[model samples]
Target: MRRRLAALLCCLLCLTGCATLAPPYETPAPASSSHWPAGAAYPTLADNAGPLAMHLPLGQVFPDQRLQQLLSLAIANNRDLRQAVIAIEQSRAQFQIEGAALLPQVDAEAQGYRERRPADLSGTGQSRITSEYRAGLGVSAYELDLFGRIRSLRDQALQTYLATEEARRAVHIGLVAEVASAWLTLAADQEHLRLARETLTSQEASYRLIQSRYDAGISSALDLHQAQTSVDNARIDIARYSRLVAQDQNALTLLVGSAIPANLLPEGLQDIRIAISEPAIGLPSQVLLQRPDILQAEHQLRAAYANIGAARAAFFPSIHLLGSFGSASAELTDLFQAGSLAWSFTPQISVPIFDAQRNRLRLRVAETERDLLLARYDKAIQTAFREVADALAAFGTLDTQLQAQRSLVDATANSYNLSQARYQQGIDSYLNVLDSQRALYRAQQELISTELGRQLNRTSLYRALGGGWYTSEPS
Candidate 1:
């Protein structure tokens, strides 16, 4: 019995040299251009000599101390990120379960039996009873995997687990960019609020001056009412910007997964800092593959290939081995005696003769899934390529646009000053002063908006470039 059990164990340990029926895996056909889009709109990158794109550290991209702290809090506390991590662990456990199918499950078992028979039935002319006891280790229905069916399933599970890991990384990268964008938006709103309040104060002073002039018969009621209208517009904007700032704060808090401390909040757009680290723009294939989403799709495609292997394997025979070795005796005390040894071995082979085309249908399903995944993988690459191209186009022109907006603001401010002085010297109508003030206010708001767009573009570029971040505060 011991020798038989040893042989069975040896058999399990010798399961090798098997190959799967799955087709060889190759990267699906390219769905997009091999190169990034380049024209007058796209930035001409001088630093394209670097390595293929990778996620720069969050700290290296967003250098603000306050922003870094916020990113850390979001990573640690965000529920979405937590869910992503849990998903990875779940997939890993499933892979482990699939891997265990190829191994024998050996365990101990014991049984007792008692029976009675009439004398006539026993042919002994007297009633008699029989008793037996047995105990030993046994193995039940362990598949030999001669065709790699179980192995293929195990590989499928492993690839799925890896895909889950890539998914988590994708979420992590997105969270960092989201936090940065939210912080910048909040700062921009705060700046807008500050400008509105200052404009309100200036308008109130102008209204009072116009009121004095009207009482002295030097300014018309039209002038006084126009000054009042300007003050009212500033007040309206103050209220609007105040509401926006509050909403921005709420949004940031949700992303952080907790209430924000006052110290970690941004003061204004001017206080936020970002560094554009231009990664080496390379072939579209190299840049797109570095994105976690793209990598995740690729893994999924590979997992589909494994599923096909498993399905094909199902068409072949499957072998299962079962065995038990132990001692048996009519008397309980004799169960383990030297002369009471007993053993049994059973092997099962299942060859699919006819199953209403079930196996063929399954194989078809697996092939279809593989094809679908391949398409999705190709689409993912194409999408990422387009995103990077769009970001590059925006980056090239934003600096010039921002500079022009600044110049417009400066010119408007100078015109407002000149018009105001002329009205006070009684050489110009108050309408000119009002028009200059309105232009100045509009230009200032546009400046703030334009600057915000420039900063937002930087954040978008960081996301498009495919980077990662530490879960903890950057030191």
Candidate 2:
């Protein structure tokens, strides 16, 4: 009889987790075009058509030694990224915790007891004493996943863990982009500061020339004051750009999570202008799927599906088994001796006969959550499409704009020189020189801005295409 019962238990164990009621999951179709949008906004690229960002790591993207070193520091020290990594570990442990539920939980225990009773309370009508001791090995209430409830839970945890890992990758990509962006901004601002100081020095010299002319009656008070005003304006700008450069440095330091070395600070944006090269963008919308944010969304949707399976199993009966084997004796010395063997086996089946529709509601909640995640997954893809398109639009026209701006600076510089020579030859008023100088300075500033814009847009395109995503997953 015992052998037959043991065989029956073995068959039950084999039959456990044989079924799942969860609906099959299907990846949602993206509501976007197969190819990049084409128009004046999305111009053709002369770049050699090749791979996307998967082959473009950070080392290739920035190429600047100082920027590369800064990126390394940020990756090693950024608190936000550290937290994301810690969250991946947390999720991994949670997955393992849930997985352990699929097996029996064995426990070992030991106990001792002593008691004395008065004669009035004793059935023997005399004072009595008793001593008892017990020791055992047991399987706690281990749920048999006949309907895949435990398996579904484990699946849900695994997917969630994977999603967390993807989230960490997303953080990493964003951090690299942010550090590079900040560094570029600092370089641009520093260039602006240097230009302002140079302008101040030139204007100071011009002021002295105008003062000497006024003393000799060769210039009017109006001319003298105007020259002084130009000098003051340069001074104001120098101060303003100085403040901006300092602020940019502070922001970059914050992103790096440590003080940046003096040598690593960018001297000018020119050095980094060609550092970030745009890829050929030869791939299709499928490339967007590789983005960490989108992958994280897909994993979360999968976890929601697993949750639905677990909820569905809640409507069926669940079986829990508790068993133990041990030896107990009244004497401590004989606790583990023969003839003192103790054992027990309990099989519990909890049928969900009725619970005021609790199980139905739980299943509904799980299904609704799945629907929510599916919608999110679809939105993530659409958002990615828009970001890439916007970056492309800016990238398409930025080079033309930069060339036009450089031409403008050259034209203004020629005009400024001619105006200054005419004023010295007494053929034109000082106003013309002042106006030309102002125009030339503004044009130069615009050229710097345009160059900076081109570089930043290149970085944006790289990020939108999910650069810096390749990394080691948790082992």
Candidate 1 residue lDDT tens string, 11-91: 755763377767889877668887776788776653343455455566777888889889999999999999999999999
Instruction: Kindly state the number of residue pairs that clash in model 2.
Output: 0
Q: Write down the lDDT of every candidate, Cα atoms only.
A: 0.85, 0.85
| Per-candidate total of colliding backbone pairs | 1, 0
Instruction: Name the best candidate (by TM-score).
Output: 2
Segments in model 2 whose C-alpha atoms lie over 4 Å from true places: 45-53, 274-278, 468-475
* Candidate 1: clashing residue pairs, number: 1
* Candidate 2 worst ten-residue window by lDDT: 45-54
